[model samples]
Target: MSEANAPRVRVLVADDHPVYREGVSRAIKARPEFELIAEAEDGRRALELVQELNPDVAVLDVQMPGLQGNDVLHAIKRDGLPTRVVLLSAHLDSETVYRAVASGAGAYLSKESSRERICDAIAAVARGEVVLSAEVQAGLASEIQIRERDQRPALTPREHEILVLTANGHSAPDIGKQLHLSQSTVKTHLKSLYEKLAVNDRAAAVAEAMRRGLLE
Candidate 1:
């Protein structure tokens, strides 16, 4: 099919590694339906190219000099660029996966993914689909579960001690005396606990803590 008549997907490839960028460029070139429009050696250049070329999809490295992949993604969104981003990273930690997805990245790919998988991700994003590698999916799932499990108000050790003392019928002054803190400081901790526990007073704070098993 002639280039003019063919349906082509324009792509921008960005990475700090010369070898890796070249490999990805070659992969994009190998597919007739895809066109390699631009390449960047850093996140800053990647954003520049995105503004200039406005490629349908951008393949960005998660770690790059000048700006990281997530930063680039935010820039694209801020500028209202009609580009879908596929983030590539060597690390697939839960936080990384969660952040990428949360930042509106179209896909998350590990550096160890096969060339075919990378190509598939690009195609998927071009088709307006959100793609997550198996590892990324697992990491995101685990992160979500952990966040849900730890949704309760977080209390510091000192706060826990204070709360326990308060539950045992100790006033702020008494608790402060036992913990070697000033009454004002004890009141400050109580205020913080009230906000965290979403309660108004001492009784409500203690009740919420007990309900969440935070006191135990």
Candidate 2:
């Protein structure tokens, strides 16, 4: 298609901050190849508009009230929506980056990103490309390194069951009863679980298991 006749990228701008949202809306409007289709003040509204409008791109704040940006992104993925999500956040922690990427956000950019950069990300994501700001990239790298450093050993099926039961605050005897195993076998599994998780106590084991995503 000729540049002039090409369809403008349908865009949704969502942020809790009115000034920032308006600025982004204005920037999208100023772009000849883009169309500002909707604005939302929170993640819930953002997701509602995405479902209702089916815009090609959604610019979302990562830390909005109600649902978070990643929450909306996950919803879009769950529903098989074609709308691409671009997450903007002032916080660039490693955990945040990991969650955003894992949840399938098309773009993750810093709130400090320029309007042009944010718009560029929207355009890139609309074309099904992944975009990440330098800060976000660094955060992701940190998260990867942290995960590698703290990699947990693979849990046996029995150990996994024990861990799940333990997370639910089940006593050793209770877990044994539920699994139809002897108390001695339960203690043995608990010992193995503690060793594998590198923790001394049940509470620490549970915390480490959760941190490693071993307990879901």
Candidate 3:
């Protein structure tokens, strides 16, 4: 199809800051390939408009009142909405980038990114491509490496201690005595460890932890 006849990609912009939202909205409006459908000042309203208008792409601020950008992204995924999402954040930490990428965001960009870059990301996302800025891409790579090196499930410090004691063949009550914790509390930690390790008993938990290098 000719460029003039091509359908514009519908877009929604949501940010708590009116100036930033307007700036982004204007950029979208100026793009010949994109159509600015709506603007929301908060996440809840963003989600509501998304459901109502079914835009092809949504540009969301990571931090917003009423519902976080991540929450809205999850809701869209849960409801199986066809709208692709582009997340914008002033904070671009590795953990944040990892979480956003893992949760199905089509793109993650710092708010400091150029308007042209944001517009390009929305266009790419609408075409079913994942877009990441250079900084975001580096952060995501670092986060993935950290995750890989620590393959163990999320265990609390107390749980790690319990696992160590259990590996030494200490019973739950014995562990409680050594740690000066109540027997019930020790058992609770043990139960949580088992659940996290996906094991049914202390021995299995210890073995799983060892295999996962949590004990090393």
Which candidate comes out best when scored by lDDT?
Answer: 3
Q: Rank the candidates by lDDT, best first.
A: 3, 1, 2
Q: For residues 56-86, could you state the per-residue lDDT of candidate 1 as single tens digits?
A: 9999999999999999999999889999999
Per-candidate RMSD, Å: 6.9, 9.6, 7.0
Writing each residue's lDDT as its tens digit, candidate 2 over 13-123 gives 999999999998998998999999999999999999999999999999989999999999999999999998999999998898898888888889999999999999988
Candidate 3 per-residue lDDT, tens place, 46-132, comes to 999999999999999999999989999999999999999999999999998898899999999999999999999998999899999
Which pairs clash in model 2? none
Positional deviation of residue 163's Cα in model 3 after best superposition, in angstroms: 19
Off by over 4 Å in 2: 152-216
lDDT of each: 0.92, 0.92, 0.93
- The parts of candidate 1 lying over 4 Å away from their true place are 1-6, 154-194, 199-216
lDDT of 3: 0.93
Error of 3 at 82 (Å): 0.3
